[model samples]
Target: MGQTIIEKILSSHSGQEARAGDIVVAELDYVMGQDGTAPLAIRAFADLGGKDVFDRERVAFVIDHSAPSPNEGVSALHKLMREFSREKGFKLYDIGEGVCHQLLPESGEVGPGSLVIGADSHTCTYGALNAFSTGVGSTDLAGGLISGKMWFKVPGTIKFVCNGVLPPGVYSKDLILYLIGRVTADGATYMAVEFTGEAIGALSQEARFTISNMAIEMGAKAGLMEADDKTFAWLRRFTSRKFTPVTADPDAVYTRVLECDAAKLEPQVARPHRVDNVVPVSGAAGKPVQQAVIGTCTNGRLEDLRIAAGILGGRKIHRDVRLIVAPSSRRVFLDAMAEGIIQTLVEAGAVMVTPGCGPCVGTHNGVPSDGETVISTANRNFKGRMGNSNAEIYLASPATVAASAVTGKITDPREFI
Candidate 1:
């Protein structure tokens, strides 16, 4: 079949051929729920006359957003979800450990080629594991609970080629930020992005994920890369179960095409509330930074940690600001400790946290106070995205964030070296 990555993934879940623009109702292998959406989804499921979930063990209900449940409204929602999941027997990961997407993969509930649905917008994070995953609203999730399926209009694919060696400070995060800046948030609306070329082949699964994780920021439905040796290596560590590796056909038709050159890039950031608003680190240099978070699903991988540790190895964070580092998974947390990255960060006064979706999603652990200005590695810095309505978030790569943490200001990473 001359299919693209999106079609290949969807076709596996569905028993029939799936092409671009075709309507599909594939059975969900897994469904995910987090605090903000789970409550409404469960309520909708009850309102729609669904008896029980399709499968209790197959569903993951996590308390991610509003982690400590900021106020009574959010706390009540948390209470309602806990009661529902426990009563109905759905898997519940209470307010502990990793973000929803980070926790799902860590628990081994999802695998390559599996179809997963979630009630959160960042649900696309599962694509890092080569699963055909996407986000859905609470209402759609309510319907899927009873029917065990959901409708998706198969999207056409876009081929993105990345070539050449990367510049010293340029990382996958900068690459994606640059791409999103150029493509604009709506550039790939309704399309899947398939990363190719020699550079993508050279990247680790974590690096590839840094690209796909922000695909939605560019308005792409799913961002995918070829399942290569790196993908297999990551999978091997996570799963002993053997499975076939899926790849797009050579002649797969694409709706659009774009290419990226890593050698020409530098550390970039998405300023303010919109992800599409990107600029070089130099432009944001000398700007004041009251906080810096160096870890999140978007940049919480091992290499990301190494980069930050290297920068913070000998320096302490600015006394005027705060720096928080959270591992993406238990595995990642353990690896960092074994590699001494953890010590380097903690010695520098960084608040190392267990793997959880804290702070990044504007929940607990790292919420900025009102009028605070912070530089972070997480995606999205929308207005009030952090708890305080007056908080301002500037998204940057791990290197930039680490450097800014050390300098107490938004200085370019190149300044540190």
Candidate 2:
């Protein structure tokens, strides 16, 4: 009879009691779109005969995917977004600012118990802050912009109870990949996943973001987590907003429950063509690689960079392999520079690029050649995900990618650690 986290958040926003499968119109605290989706959303707003947005301060646009205008066509779209933001007096993040998911939390547009919707599937990333966030189509995003509210059918919750301590060489990425492999890509379709227990609670806020960012990969609507002192501390560092943390009732209903032991997990990799086609590092070890990428919206935080630098400090990558490093945001880039993490990576034969969603989206940089293999820290690994169906992608933790970069093959991070 108790409400889960998603139900409670939706109820608060809708001004009524909400239950799974109930349709309600909930007020939105924030809405966002990036270059990849903003053009369509802007056009949709005009098509809807929308005038000024409901709130200029609550709507934002970020130009990150295919940043710096990969081609004249993308440049024109960026120009349109810029003009629209200027005309509407809405906030706009220009090139190299960061991915929308990373920038939103950094700018404090998201907080616990807030309702957020974005034009990007990874908008679910904000759920790490304990918000009820999900992705909407361009038309839905336009409606939310014009009216400051959107409708939702409350989703049933799937509880993932992870216990025990993570091993030294393992991390949140490995744990998430392992979970995805178990559940398969469509296992949690249209449902909300609530990650809990000691292992998840022990992770850093950034790590939690990585987990939430990938929820959509498993066909989840949103990923929710409980807030504690660590969550508040992380929020305080960005904004002074007061947030009321939400927790599920002890007897909240769940569609299914999965219990995992973190101590039993090892580094995991999702082979090409499908994210769910995952295997342990040893299962795919020694496979040759032509490129290795160490950043994305999922694992491009400062902690991720430090993990890579720790392995490549006094070493150089394989001569046959190309290592690409991209910081997630300008702040992360500058902080890494101040701490010499950037220098360590570059001196170790890594090529540093601007902070944005470059290689991950296959928009502009680091596109592999035909018949080549790449190991990356990005979330997805479908065919042609990196701009070429002929080039294969292997998804792994940053440590695994860095270690593989050094050896020109798929190598286990535990060996390097």
Candidate 3:
């Protein structure tokens, strides 16, 4: 009845009255960076003759992407980032800690009622925990690195209400992909995204993370769901930090609203190059797939692995397709191993890699051939995004990726399930 999650986070950072479309300067509660983009900001920081970052401890640098670089140039770039972090008093998250967004929440740096800015696009992933987070460019990051405060034109929010339940083999990725067809890529540009409805309340933290993580593809500043009991219960195991929950005001004005009674959804896919290039599952069926890779900050949870494993338990990967999988974090990886998921996947002809954002970022591992096509569980199918610019990439849910791995072609997940 008061304000939405985005509004509450902004209010905590703003002392005076705040309203949508107002250009307000708010001090960032957390500043995040990863290997690929951190060095750029560092270079700009030096060019500005900055002595030390504003509130060094609040700035976080992560070495998750291309950690052990796939090439020499990438390795050198990572070295520069390491040097920058060592010189600055920032909290540099080194290799093995995990992806930037995951480590942010895992370290308790992302709390409720805080505004966070990250150099990486998927920074909105933190919104699952009720923080207002968004991505920024290196230039803006440099400004924030020098001054703790940054400018944001408060964005109007579009509410997405989901009711009913998801069928087996379906996930948040499917829902978002389907919605992209409705809203397109630029639909939410400069607009905050607030997700509601019973399905959202019932989602696991991992599942919710999947939704908020991909919100960036919709050009969304942030995506938030009500932090109800499930979120609180999950946080209890991770931190002792206490904070107030923020939700949308009953009468909050939304520039637009989307409603989906999720029970009607089937496995959905976004065909190559653009997140908004969405179509029904049947549209992509029977198309030959040369590779099937799973794992990313989104849909890299243990539950995602379990679903793929159940489907691939006794089957071998398609003769023409390669199957690879990566866990989201060390914790998720450990849990999967303890439950024999690793063995099941390996036995079923899948390659299990370390926990990191590899294929998703298109830097390390899982490089496909020039003309090959792949069915990926990671977000984004941007042309040349996965290596060879000419290679085709199709984006889909884990179930679809798994089914394709077994059949060597894009098949509706419903058939396999």
Candidate 4:
């Protein structure tokens, strides 16, 4: 009986053989919290009588969501996080740095086969490196901070084998949106999803990050891709730390197997209020859009910005559409600027905001007005997700958003590409 990737990682951390449905206490390599959750975690840690973290170096706090202090209240929260990090001697990433998920990988805090837990649900984004990363509530994070160990009920793995070549203008976002639509958002609840096959292997590390970043939309515990040469190559660019890539055994059991024909996939869009309410872009084309965003942890990588810039180059956005662009990290922002991607977007009538999660959570930048329609590259389009319950939010790839920004409607990216 071979073990799945999750099983193997858990077993290695637990120092014993393990399987799905088994609760095991495993040592964690990293623990993190952001401004929205760190204060709660700090409070919980103090309540546990934890005078000090088990490993100060392994803990991190990032002030990202609503960064640059949306209000005095958020500023107070930032102050609290700063005070806590100072008191605990842990690492802290402050405003203008970027979203926690993107910054962590950029900082080389995430690696293959490590167990990482963060207070943000999107912490699962690190699974792109084959790490066993998951999101937890503040209480669980507090416990991990105090003891350096956490309990996990190992989850069954769902294998998604993506074969064939991706068609023109199609992206990992479109592929994941298609999967989420088929899986119906909560279909993979409490399970691990491991992407495999030639398409997965061929994806850039950033593209893999996009796919794994959205796995939470399907209610997955973790979304992972097997670490391979490309993974190592990407990691090398950031850190010289050697990581032993973790792979599923040849006969590892899966709850179920799904096959995706990447060549046949089309541009997809998630309609207002539900990620699973996805349809081909054609279904939503010609619908008016007053706003379009081309950035988020889900699609705000350098490649994503390049794709949007390529489509928007030399073309102005529609007069009716307000286009906002945010780079996922300061590093990505600088790289984009060096490559002229930012200037191209700005020249194309897009508003470039800070590197932090601009307009994604509706906290600070680019919030839509009542009854307006927005096409965005960000994940989640639930009612009130963008700080306005009356606004309609549609989710699409960066290229789709870029094309639509020019046309002021839901336009298929293929037409522009």
The candidate that wins on lDDT is: 2
Per-candidate TM-scores read 0.94, 0.99, 0.96, 0.99
RMSD of each: 2.0, 0.7, 1.6, 0.8
- Candidate 1 structure quality by residue, lDDT tens digits, 138-250: 99888877777888899998888888866777788888899999999999999888777877776777787788788888888887766667777777776676656567898
Q: Per-residue alpha-carbon lDDT of model 4 for 1-417, expressed as tens digits?
A: 999999999999998898999999999999999988999998999898888898988999998888888799998889999999998899999998988889989878688998999999888999999998999999999999999999999999999999987788999999999999998888899999998888888789999999999999999999988898888888888998888888899999999999989989999999999999999999999999999998888999999999999999999999999999989999999999999999999999999888878888879897899999999999899999999999999999999999999998999988987
Report the C-alpha displacement of residue 210, candidate 2, in angstroms: 0.8
Q: In model 3, which runs have C-alpha deviations exceeding 4 angstroms?
A: none
Q: Which residue runs of candidate 4 sit more than 4 Å off their true CA positions?
A: none
Give the higher-TM-score candidate: 3 or 4: 4
Cα shift from native, residue 46, model 4 (Å): 1.0
**Per-residue accuracy of model 2 over 266-330 as CA lDDT, tens digit each:** 99999987889999999999999999999889999999999999999999999999999888999
Which candidate, 1 or 2, has the higher lDDT? Answer: 2
Residues 345-392, model 3: lDDT tens digits: 999889877677867767767888898998898888889888778789
Residue-level lDDT for 192 in candidate 3 = 92
lDDT of 1: 0.81
Q: To one decimal, what is the Cα RMSD in angstroms of model 3 from the true structure? A: 1.6
Which 10-residue span in candidate 2 carries the lowest summed lDDT? 356-365
Number of the candidate with higher TM-score, 1 or 3: 3
